[model samples]
Target: MPDFDFTALRRFPDVEADNLFAYDASDHLILDEAADDLHAAAPGEVVVIGDRYGALTLGALALHDAADIRTHQDSYTGELALQNNAAATGVTGFRSLDLGEELLTGSRVVLMQMPKSLSELDEVAETIARFADPSVTVFAGGRLKHMSIAMNEVLGRHFGDVRASLGRQKSRVIRARDPRPSAESAWPQRAYLDELGLWVVAHGAAFAGPKLDLGTRELLRHLDEMNPDARTAVDLGCGTGLLATALARTRPELAVLATDTSAAAVASTRATAEANEVAITVRRDDGLSQQPDACADLVLLNPPFHTGSTVHAGVALRLFEEAARVLKPGGELWTVYNSHLTYRPALYRIVGGTRQVSRTPKFTVTVSTAR
Candidate 1:
């Protein structure tokens, strides 16, 4: 094993702040717990999922001499960060892949950063069980505060044996083996939101997962009033493409684009749009970075308040700035967020003149016009 410096990793291209981090105790603990399996596995037998940056992938490559490592990172930002970190560390051999057979097939050892969502965990576990070698061992780690008994139960559904390791630095790893592959994958779930008259489709990692979140529901109420003459609209951070599909369905002439950082979210949005027979251009993007400046007449956002498990407003603020950058002068940016965030002042400063569209006890919807 080589001496690997986890602290040297950086979350570049992702939101970086004094408090936000590229790696965590969980990453080290997972690597440590799975060290034997990782080292003993044959070339191309190790697969990493949910690597926030390149911590697990790079650590496995550098420390275990793991070869032909295949990894899946849901966030596009995480993928870019991994690329940047690998280049900086001069670590090679790992390939970023989507969550499917190609990434998991013949995988004897799997290292994962446990997702916060149970559905996401289930999806990953099912995929591993279905595709990985029968003798595969999974090391799924997360901060103790985020780990729940439900996660064990979720993994147990796909793996016959599951056990937990002792906590280290407030992180713990769950080891699972004896694959119990299911006949079908329960992912890419769908539900009809009768109230909204829309069919929501979601992959496990998609936010709110095939359901209309309260914040989005509030914003949906005002979609008809958003830039009435707008010809081009963007559903920034479109989860399940509810807003994008709704906008397209209501205004067929509008050119709708849905952009999200999460691959699952982008896929879900595309599926949602297709299911509704609405034409929405879906892109896996870091906010509206790929869109040209002043190109959008309206941008709808239900900005997430959290960056991973941390309750940070930085992610939402960054999206606000992106929405502002992509909006034409006088274009409207309709945003829905938790009321406690009080993003009005920030929106006014970052986007333009802002006004409350609607407010509830828990959520607030506001529209900001580009200055």
Candidate 2:
């Protein structure tokens, strides 16, 4: 099969807008601004982040030799798109890693794709600051909506000196020159709930940040009731690993498999497991590709409905089908999604039975079982 290409969305002004095969010709912000800066960068061992759909990572990897440098990633889709685009483009040498993974302790340049969460960006900047200096040139791009005076403050706080390029096609790029080294914190460990108290593993990405989401909080409630007597169970789309953590907490006798598309999420779960001192299997997987057929007793999912600009049922539908494929007869999938999604019809077709267990104004939970 041909390598999957990422489809670009408008308004997420980013440094790697055009590197994607699915580039939006209509992209009018950071794409143009970042393109100009990238052309002038003398690349070697550069780390790129927030490359939504992976234009910047692809560019850095293809533009530089791996022996000279490496590119790291943390965005969920960014990793997926980066590997896909790399294979399709026949680009080699560069390996994709997550922020939750070890960061560039020796990277010379950092190319950042600003995220929607300014707090996240601040965290990234602080992480890089530990190793950044005047020798480290940080180049970043974003849309007008995100490019603000406040952003400059964050940049200044982490890196000493900064400048920006003129907006081209509504895009702007900031150049931060780090003169003095910034203090680095020990990587924060992921926290998992357990009898041991707190599980903490230093993860540098989006997975096990400070708090848990509401959907996962609700899903965690049913984990104790889940039949763990089966040989194996999987927590699909485990974010921050709260679901996986509960599974491990309740079923000390079973080896719980935890998986997610996000590298950070996977690492966080692993960290959570370690911090809680609970033993569970964790991996980065697209849906349940790594699972064996008829192997799981339960597949827990809080499936996301969209990726960037695309809002479709593709993710949820795939998880359901994959759950059925890997589930033994009578095995079930317990999942949650926004209440607005019409998932019942899709669930009925994928599983033998679909039951609505609970709902809120914004989200709903369903239990699907195979006959």
Best by lDDT: 1
Backbone clashes per model, in order? Answer: 0, 12
Per-residue lDDT tens digits for candidate 2, residues 184-266, read 55445444445334454534555336466677767766776665456678888776666676677777776789887766677
lDDT of 1 by residue, 92-123 (tens): 99888889999999999999999989989988
Q: How well does each candidate superpose onto the true structure, as a TM-score?
A: 0.98, 0.79
Alpha-carbon error at 145 in model 2, in Å?
A: 4.5
- What's the lDDT for candidate 1? 0.92
Error of 1 at 262 (Å): 0.9
